[model samples]
Target: MTLSVKAVAARLEIGRIDWSAYRAPASGGPGLRDLFLGLLDANDESEAVGCSLEYRLEVQSMVYEVALPAVGVILAAYAEDLPLWVEMEFLNVLHNIITGEPHRSELELGNFDLVDRCIERARDGIWVMYSRLSKWNSDFLLDVLEVVDSDRERFAVFKAGFYPE
Candidate 1:
C-alpha cells in the first residue's frame, strides 16, 4: 500500500484539510517570506541580549517538529532503497515548518540548493553512524541507497516488503 495524502491524514487523525485555504497562488504573505529568510540567515550569536531576543522570537515562531507519518511509512516500505528526492522533499517540508513557515505557503517555495546540501549531509551522517550497524546487523544502508536511487517518481506509493501480498 502506497502512502497517500488521504492515508496520511487518516493516520494523523486530522479532519479533511481545506485545500483552498492551503493553496498558495504566488506573491502572497511577505511576512512569512521575510521570516523564512531571516531564519535561513540566523547564525550562532553569543551576544547575550541579541541571543535572548532571538531565542524568544524563535520560541514563539518555530514549529519545533512536524508529523510526517506518510514519510515514515514510505521510508519503512522502501527501506531497501529510500527515495532521495522524496526524502529531500520531506526534509524540506520539515525544515520549513521548523522555521515557522507554513508548509503550503507560497513564500515557502522549494529551495533546491538548501535541499541538496541537506541531503548530502544526511547521507554522510547516515553512512558514518550506521556503517557499523549495517556491517553487524544487515545491509540496511545499501538497501536504503538502492531504494532512493530506484524510485524517481514523486509521491508514489511504497509497499513495505513485509506487507501482505
Candidate 2:
C-alpha cells in the first residue's frame, strides 16, 4: 500500500506539490510555523509504528481560523489506530490547561521552569502520535476504512481455516 509522495499529494487534492529532500533546520525558527500532514508506516502488516511527518503548532497559531482538510481526512480513515493511552494523555493535558488544574499549581509552586519543560515535552509527544497516522491517498485511506477487507484479516482467516488456530 506504499505510495509516492506526489500520488499522495494528488489524492489529497494538493494542487501544488513539493518534494524537496527533508533537512533538519539548524535552530528553531522564531515565528515560523508549519502544519504537517503525516503518514503512518506499519511495523508489520497490521500495526502502525512510525510516521513520516511530525509537526508542532505554537499557541499564537491557534488564534487564527484555518481549515485543515488533511487532518479531517486522515482522522476519518484511521481513527482506529489512535491508542487509548494517548487519548487519555491528551484529555488530561487539555483539562489541565482549560481548568487551570495541576499545571497552574506547579507554576505557582516555584516549579515554573520544570512545568514549562514538561509542557514542551508533552506537546511533542502528543503531536507526534496525533500526526503519526495521517496521510494522503484517499483511495487507500478508504480501503483501510473497510474493516473486513484487510490483509491481516485474510491472514487470520487462513491461520484459522488451514492451520490449527
Q: What digit string (tens of lDDT, one per residue) describes model 1 on residues 50-151?
A: 211122212333321122222232223223332343333333443332334323322255532332332333343343323222232233333344333334
TM-score of each: 0.23, 0.22
Considering every candidate listed, which one attains the maximal lDDT? 1
Question: Model 1, which residues run further than 4 Å from truth?
Answer: 1-15, 23-82, 101-165
Residue runs of model 2 more than 4 Å from their true location after superposition:
1-39, 42-67, 80-165
Cα lDDT listed for each candidate: 0.29, 0.29
Per-candidate Cα RMSD to the true structure, in Å, reads 17.3, 15.5
Return the top candidate by TM-score.
1
Give the Å shift of residue 36 in candidate 2. Answer: 6.7
TM-score, structure 1 vs. true? 0.23
Candidate 1 pairs with clashing backbones: 80-143, 81-146, 81-147, 81-148, 82-148
